[model samples]
Target: MGVLSGVKIIEMVGLGPGPFCGMLLADLGADVIAVERPAADAGNPRPWELCSRGKRSMVLDVKKPGAVETFLELIDGADALIEGMRPGVMERLGLGPEVCLARRPSLVYGRMTGWGQYGPLSQVAGHDANYVAVSGALWLATQSGQQPDAPPGLLGDVAGGALYLAIGLLAGILRARQDGQGQVVDAAMVDGSAHLLNFAISFLPDHYGGSFEKARPAALGMHWDRPYLCADGEWIVIQAVEPKFYAELIRRLGLDQDERFVNEQRNPAAWATLGDELSVLFKTKSRAEWTRLLEGTDTCFAPVLAPEEAAAHPHNIARDIYKTIDGVLQTAPAPRFSVTPSAELVSVPPRGAHTKDVLAELQINSKRTGDRGQATAVGSPG
Candidate 1:
């Protein structure tokens, strides 16, 4: 049994982070019921939607006759409900928070959006890039007077949306359990993305006497934490920042005799030159050689690991960070527990594959259904 063993949640289906959130919840042993539109609306199935993994599915034509009642019936028994629709869409469909709360007072309602529920851009169509771009995140990437580089959508969608939503869901679950009451959790990507830059923002105040652009040369910036190439075309991250760590790095690199590289304060002016010198020195050694020299040391150094390499890492493999499900590789449940560990992946069902099972669990009759076959994908389940 997982920590969230008996918890039940109703997830209104949407793209991207919404489904990812539901997947995380379901992975933690919550009975996530993914409500999908009927075949009439989207007859062509989305089989390999990874978000639908670890969840049971129910198909309801919200536009049809009794679908609203069907949805409420599920919500009536659920402890939490997540939706990613626009602000007024759920209300228009007669499945708003107010109505759901009236039915189930202790139901934690989670709303996921790009701009949020009440902002001016609430109704606007946007994705991960748009959200983070406006939140000063995209603007902060350029170190020099160069064009801004897209940091990919992971920062906004996965980190900001999926991870934040999961945290909110868990926190909401805790509160609802302890107080016997539920509240709305608003997880906006823009808000989360902006909050992601909180640490960097702390150094940008006027009292700090310098802007973020000017502070790039500081020791705490990404310039110091970036990856460096090794002799074998592999990259390694060296965090020789603090005095002690820098001293250890110097010892590992056998550069103690270099007087200029020995002084931290004086090294700032020659950072570019020193960086080039260190890069050249690193290129003379392979990643394995550097690892052997600095592995257990306090140098704060690590090699850049590919996904496959990460899965087989000593620490990760010891902790069982990845698991195989139906012959496919995927991540295991995170945030381990001393007791009541999260359930391992038994099997993943296809999209709409669990319609009958879900409706049956809700004590609804599926016998009278027409020739509505189960929906499944080839590679993976969402």
Candidate 2:
């Protein structure tokens, strides 16, 4: 059991962020019912849909008769409901916040989207990159002369979208329990991405002419706060942002005596010159050599390890941060608790695998469902 042991949630499984939010809630021991499209791929569930882990899935085609009513039955008994359809889809399907809240006065309705409900772009379609790009969040990843790019889904989907919705739902549920009222939470990747940039914004006035549109920020321009390539072609990073840590970095590297490293740490004038020098210097040593000399020190150093390498890393192994489940490698649920730990990992299930059971539990009957309910699905995920 986990901290959210008794929480009840109904999730309308959609793309990326919505399923991820559901997975996170389930990981914390919420009793989650994932209402998926009837056409989802049950015969071939993808590994990344690890988002299905610990969730009980029900397949219901809202287009079919009695489907919306079935969902309402779930909503009536749930503490919260999450959905990621385009702004009006739920309304069109007759499962909007107003209707659900009427059914359950204290139900938390969480919506995840790229733009947000009522925004100019809310009804439009978008993916993770477009959301961050429009929010000015992608500029943080831009380096000199490089196009803005990042690992897909991390910034906008997982962080800005999924995580924000998860927390928003939890907060709403808490308030609902106390106040006996509920409201909808509009969690947009655009809004959350902009909020996530607040910390980097603090250093903006001294960076790139004080605007993200101009160029990279100050930290990227720092001599000691950059990635270096080793002779063996592996990459290593050091982000000694503080002065004392900067001193530790150069001293450990025996560059304290170097004239270029002697200047004030924020001196942008010295960055390019020192970067050129350090680039050549770092290439002289393999990553292993630098790991021995500087790793586990105050230099804020880390070697860039790919997923498999990260799983094999000593620190990661010691902390039990990564594990293989059903032959797919993924990180463990984060934000460790000293008291109630995260629930055990559960294997992914076929889509709509529990449709009959769920329908039976709710004693629901629709034209599309029978005593045994829908069969295993073979279509792709939504």
Error of 2 at 38 (Å): 3.1
* Among all candidates shown, the one with the greatest lDDT: 2
Clashing pairs in 2: none
For each candidate in the order shown, give its overall lDDT on alpha carbons: 0.74, 0.82
- Model 1 is weakest, by summed lDDT over 10 consecutive residues, at 373-382
TM-score, candidate number 1: 0.87
| TM-score of every model versus the real structure | 0.87, 0.91
In lDDT terms, how accurate is model 2? 0.82
Candidate 1: stretches off by over 4 Å? 38-48, 203-210, 214-224, 367-382
Tens digits of per-residue lDDT, candidate 2, 1-382, equal: 7888899999987777988999998888898998875454432444347888889987776655556677898887799998888888788778889899999999999998989987677777789999999987887766757777878899999989999999999999999999989999999999999898887777668755687654464344666878899999999998898888998999998988876696657777778888888899999999999999999999999999999999999999999989899898988887788898988786787777888788877876544443234432122211
Against the true structure, whose TM-score is highest?
2
Clashing residue pairs in all predictions, respectively, total 4, 0
Estimate candidate 1's alpha-carbon lDDT, on a 0 to 1 scale: 0.74
